[model samples]
Structure formats: C-alpha cells, structure tokens
Target: EMGHVLGIGTLWDTFGLLKDFPGPNPTFVGPGAMKEFGTLIGAGQPTPVPVANVGGAGSAGGHWRERVFGNELMSPTIGGPGNPLSRLTVASLGDLGYQVDLDAAEPYALPDPFVIAMAGGGETAPPRGVMLPTVPSSVPADRP
Candidate 1:
C-alpha cells in the first residue's frame, strides 16, 4: 500500500496564482525534489544545471570587443569626390540680354549694325550720383 505508506503531508499555506486545486497536489517541487524527479525520469547528466547568471563582468567586456572589431570604420567624408577649391564660385550671369547664333549652318547672315551700335554707345562710366543711392545719411530729405 504505497499510497497509505507514502508519508506525504501538506505543510504551511503558500500563496500562488492557482489556489482552487485539490490535496497533495503541489504546483511545483523544491530543487532537491526536482533532482530526485530527474533521477527517476532517467535523464542523464542531471540535465546540466544551468549556470545562474555566470560571467557577469566578463560578459560586459564582450560588447567592448564587438564595438572595437565588428563594426566598419567610416571615412570623414562619406560619399563622392572632394572639391579642390576652399570657396566655391557660383557664377550667376543674368540673362545675356541678347544671344547671337554665330554657328548657323546656312548662308551667313550679318548682325544688325544698329543693334551693335546701340550696345556700345551707352555711358562707359557710372553716373555722378552713383553713390547717392547708398548714402542714406547724406540724403536731401535728411538734411538740417
């Protein structure tokens, strides 16, 4: 009569999530009982007791090794070729007032002499009051 002779006793009350189930039925056994159960189940090598949080400080240094060696070393300049000049020149010539097609393949046409004459005849020098626009303090309206 193994059932009658089995000296099983429910000890002090323990709080758990599952409380509705019946007698001698424990949710979990202690570590020693687990080892005994492992022997009874014929699991070889005691199932290799897990290394509890081993290699703590040593594991922290593993990431340092990975950061040093595992990643790519990037250049200071990411992509494309570098520019030769320190100051970039942005030449923005406003619309060439008029364009001439000197390379027209057909019979050559002479450009209008009047247009060329007008182009060269404007005042070569800036006006006497050229700086007047910039001198706000010298303006006639501001005079005492």
Candidate 2:
C-alpha cells in the first residue's frame, strides 16, 4: 500500500516547519468529487474521506481498496495485468500543493460496484495506465 501523510496539508506543514518552505497548504477538492469533470474551485476543500484504516496504520490496508478502485495505482493490490494511473491521484497532488500537468495525467473512471461480495468473485474493473510525475525543486524532497 502507498504510505503518505494523512492529507496533503499535513505534508505541506511538515515541510514548512522543517525546511522553511513557502506555498499553499494542500487541501481537498471539496467534501466530495465534483459533479463535472476537469474543474477546480476558487477555494480549496477538505481532504478526501480516507479509508477507515481501523486495525492499525501503514500496512497493506494503507491504500484505497482494489475492489473499489479496480486497477487504480493507489489500490493496495496490483493483481491485474494492467494498472491505471487515475486523475484523482493527480488532483490529490494538486491538493498537496504541487503544480500538476493535468494533461499528462492518465484518465480514470471511478468504479461503479452495485454489489461487493465478500469473495473475489465480482465485477471486473477497467484498465488504467501508470502515470508518474516529477516533483519540482520548489516542493519538498520525497521522504519516508
């Protein structure tokens, strides 16, 4: 699972206090995803609703569920032959206070699972690409 700060704002603050940096603190798009696609509001929103992560922190459970995200890169498991680099992730980077090349981000369709069975037998998700972006020098160095 991908391990990151609970939210982009947290990451920003940590870097700011530690490295004496300046920039907008990360923020969510809104309470939820926007109704329309490819849009950003004037003011930033709250962070996305994270997975409960009830048992403990930072394990295989640290990421979005595969059953829910299908082949999205942040999903805990990568069992599929192909992986999808979701726009959500890119937007999340924007939330993390980085300049994103949205055009370079791979598009993804959120999954629509009518029924999620306990077993692995369920609807199949669409394929997505592996989109990676470079963090500019203005941003904090990647740290564990």
Candidate 3:
C-alpha cells in the first residue's frame, strides 16, 4: 500500500522505472535497482552484485535481493525482530519518485547474520498487516 502511494512496485510487469538501462531482460532487481537508485554498485562496476528476483505476482523481480538483504525490511521475507531500514532502500524510494531523507536512513550490514527461517514448504505469511474476520457460511451481512 505504502509502496503504491510512493510509486515503488508497478501494477504491471513493465519495468518502466528501469527503462533507462539497456538489456534484453524485461525485469530487474537488486543491483540493477541499486544502480537505478543512484548507486555505483550495479553492472559494469568492479564487483557488480544484483538483488534477488523473487518472481511472484506483484513482488517478483522487483524487491531487493533476499539473500543479500536477508532480514532487511525491504526483502520479500519479513523476519522477526524486524529488519533494517537501509540506505539502499531509501535510495530506491528516491528512484521511485519519492522525496527521501537520506540522513534518516538506518544503518545496514551486508549478509545479515540474523536471517529468520520461514515455515515449512517454503510458505510465508501473508503480506497484509491486518487480518479480516471470516463470516460464517450462509450468513449474510444484513443479518444480526
């Protein structure tokens, strides 16, 4: 939701935000994203590191690399104990056309040491923060 308001993820698979770069690939994430975020850490650099391509409906090939950021807030996974609000994330926000306060970015460490494992079958919790109550079968909203 916040990302929508801030213009992060796109409603379609088109990487219009990253149209400036040249490549046959249609989607980009991580280092490509970092580069777009005004960082010198992407392709053509001495050590070009790219982010993970989650490849889901809305988050795939869009969010920051999971293995690189691990428990960092922007990664697909939201582990317990919370994640860091990294400068890279803020920079991405800026790339997304948001006015970011770079000074307010949180300190982040690479290869986060505390990556919380997800549940079995590689299933993760729903992304939504609020849970809606389920209505009983055959029950109508107008009924008491």
Candidate 4:
C-alpha cells in the first residue's frame, strides 16, 4: 500500500517513532502524530498512537492497531466500503521528515464504541477512497 511505500508504519522504529516493539503494547510516539491523535479522538492531551503487536511477523510491528484505529487506511484489516487516511496518519509523515500537507489527508474518526456495541459490533467505515487491499493471510516473500 502507499502507506508502506511512504514508510509510514515501516519506518517508525527507524525514525524513532515506535516504542516497545514486539511487546504486548507497542505504540507510536511521534510528536506530530501524538498531537493529532488527541484532537482526532477528542482527548485533552496528546496521546500515543497504538501500534499493532499481535498480527505476527509482517504485521504486528508495522501498523496502527486495528482495535483502536479500525478501518483507518493504515491499519491492517481493512474491511471497507471506504477508508479515510486520517490527519494522525499524515502528521506522522512529518515526523518522518516529509513536508506534508495535513489538509491533503482525508477525514476520519474512530468509531464510537458505544455505537458499535449498540449496533451489534459492526463497523461503519467513513466513505472516502475505495477499499485498500487486505493484508494477505501469508506474508509475502518480498517483504521483510
């Protein structure tokens, strides 16, 4: 995906944005993403972006955790009618040394848990771009 091509999740640790990798609670600690995350989720203070840590060798350490960022473009499991690339994702690109325009990011929001539960645990992804390719069941030989 373009996110990988742009080194979004892939370059996190290399760029010093990833923390506690290969653990139960890997997180992204980039200032730009952290600041945007708080605003995205309506938290009063900056928040660490949760990173995937359970999807095995190719996935675990290289994506936003689906539990929190469900259906967002950078998360691994994309069951989409649509997927939006959020500002939090775009801001992290700034942490990676790219001169990015946050305005270029598509609008997105975390699905409200109360709403999800009430609706029987189905997600309603915000319509934006078409669906992204799902992570293959097996990791490709080409990727590390």
Candidate 5:
C-alpha cells in the first residue's frame, strides 16, 4: 500500500502545480515475476473477443451497476493512491487564462503539497499587466 501511495505522490510531485518540475517516472522492480503473474491470471480467463467488435451490442446494462453504485460513493474531495490531482480553479487575468491543478496525494505522503503559480497572456499585454518588468529609473544617473 505504501508503494502505491508513494507512486501517487511521485506522480503529483512531478506533474502537480509546478509543471516545470520533473521526475516521477516508474521503475519496474520485477519484470519477469510481474509478467509471470499476469500470464498465470490470463491463462484461465474467458475467451478473447475480436478487437473490432469487443463492445458488440447490448453492453448498456453492464454499465448500470457502475452508474448506480458509483454515484453513491462519489465524494467532493476523495484523495487516495489512484487519484493524484484535481483541477481546482480556472480564471482569467486581463487577457490571459490561468488554470490550477492541485496535488491530492495522501496526507502522509505529502503533508503539505507545494502551491505553484503560473501565468499566461495574449499576444499583446496579458489580462493582468506584466507581473514584474524592468523600469527606467526616474532619478537622473548623474544626480546620485
């Protein structure tokens, strides 16, 4: 469980708010063992369906169970090993649009997820003026 939780954390740490930050690639520990286990499970599985007609005709009823039972367990903020991030905000600044993705990793993995800020603007000036830009000093250079 901890490995799965860490994997989720690694995913968030790499792709979370700080989109510039890198890392969180998976490292396969046991390639042979994992493949063998998968093969064993697949050996006794149902017959293979043709790729073209996999979801043939009457598959609507199959989804009924998910639609009914899934909604009951829905949560506004359910963080776990699988769900790593959530889009929390979308707002416009001047002419630019901004989006925020939050890391929803477990509490233990990341006690406090870092917050990152990013800005985007149009071809001209952004909706909000240039955040920080060089400005010519009003004071004459010779005076000082």
Candidate 6:
C-alpha cells in the first residue's frame, strides 16, 4: 500500500510518533494526525489514534486498525462505504512530515459502532461526524 511505502505505521517509531508500542495499547501520537482524528470523530480535543496490532506483520503494525477505522483507506482490510479518502489519511501524511492541504481532503466520517452492531446487516465502522473513541464490548473492539 502507498501508506505502507510512506511508513505511516511501519516507521511510526522512527518518526517519534508512536508510543507504548507492541503492547495492549500502541498509539499513534502524531500531533497532526491526532488532531485530525479528533476532528473526524468530532472530539473537540486532540485524541490518540490507535495503531493496529492484528493481521500479522504486513498489516498488524503497518496500518490503522480495521475495526476502528472500518473501511478507511489505510485500514488493514478493505470493504465499506467506498473506503473514502478522508482527511484522517491526509493529516497522517502531514504527520509523516509532508505538507498537505486539509481543504483539499474529501469529506468522510465513521459510522456508529453501536448502530452497526445493532443493524447486524451492514457497515461496521464509526459513522461520519460521530466517530466514537470506544467500542462497546458487544462490538469487535479491534485495535483502532
């Protein structure tokens, strides 16, 4: 994946953006991505974006958790609402030390996990504008 090539997760430590790695809660602390993640989820304050710890080597530590981000472009797995290229990914690039235009980012938001679990039929990601920070026990609760 292009994100892998850019080291979004793979080089997190190298960039000094990762903390508490290889544990129960490895987090991505890139300021830009953190801020954007909060914005994407409507969290008024910056929130820590989670780095995946599943799917083995190529995917585990090299991509956003599939459960949390759902079909996000950088998620380990693929399948969701178009896998929209939301500002979350763009901001991550900025965190990776690349200049970017937040304005140019396409609008995207996660689906409600509760609703998704309840629906038991469709999308399982956080909903747009209402990205939740925690997944209820009933939900899969993947790393993101």
lDDT of each: 0.22, 0.43, 0.51, 0.83, 0.21, 0.75
How many clashing residue pairs are found in candidate 1? 0
Model 6, stretches more than 4 Å misplaced?
Answer: 115-144
Ranking by TM-score: 4, 6, 3, 2, 1, 5
Residue-pair clashes per candidate, as listed?
A: 0, 3, 5, 0, 4, 7
lDDT of 3 by residue, 34-139 (tens): 4533443344442322333444655454455565556656666665876777776676676555677866877766662343243232224336677778876787
* lDDT per residue as tens, model 5, 52-75: 111212211111111111111111
Candidate 2 C-alpha lDDT tens digits along 67-117: 556566665556666666565655555545566665666767655565345
RMSD in order of candidates: 42.5, 19.2, 11.7, 13.6, 21.8, 12.9
List residue ranges in candidate 2 displaced over 4 A. Answer: 1-47, 50-56, 59-61, 114-144
TM-score of each: 0.18, 0.45, 0.53, 0.77, 0.14, 0.74
Candidate whose lDDT is highest: 4
Candidate 5, lDDT over the whole model: 0.21
**Lowest lDDT 10-mer window, candidate 6?**
119-128
> Can you write out model 6's per-residue Cα lDDT over 5-67, one digit (the tens) per residue?
887777888988888767767778888888988887788989989777655677656777665
The order of the candidates by lDDT, greatest first, is 4, 6, 3, 2, 1, 5
Clashing pairs in 1: none
Q: How many angstroms is residue 70 displaced in model 4 relative to the true structure, after the best TM-score fit?
A: 0.9
Of 1 and 5, which scores higher on TM-score?
A: 1
Error of 6 at 100 (Å): 0.8
For model 1, residues 1-144, the per-residue Cα lDDT tens digits are 111122111210131211212322222232332342244335642221111111233222111111111111111111244311110000000011123232221221222446535655211332356354555555587567
Between which residue pairs do clashes occur in model 2?
83-128, 84-128, 84-129
Off by over 4 Å in 1: 1-8, 12-20, 23-27, 44-144
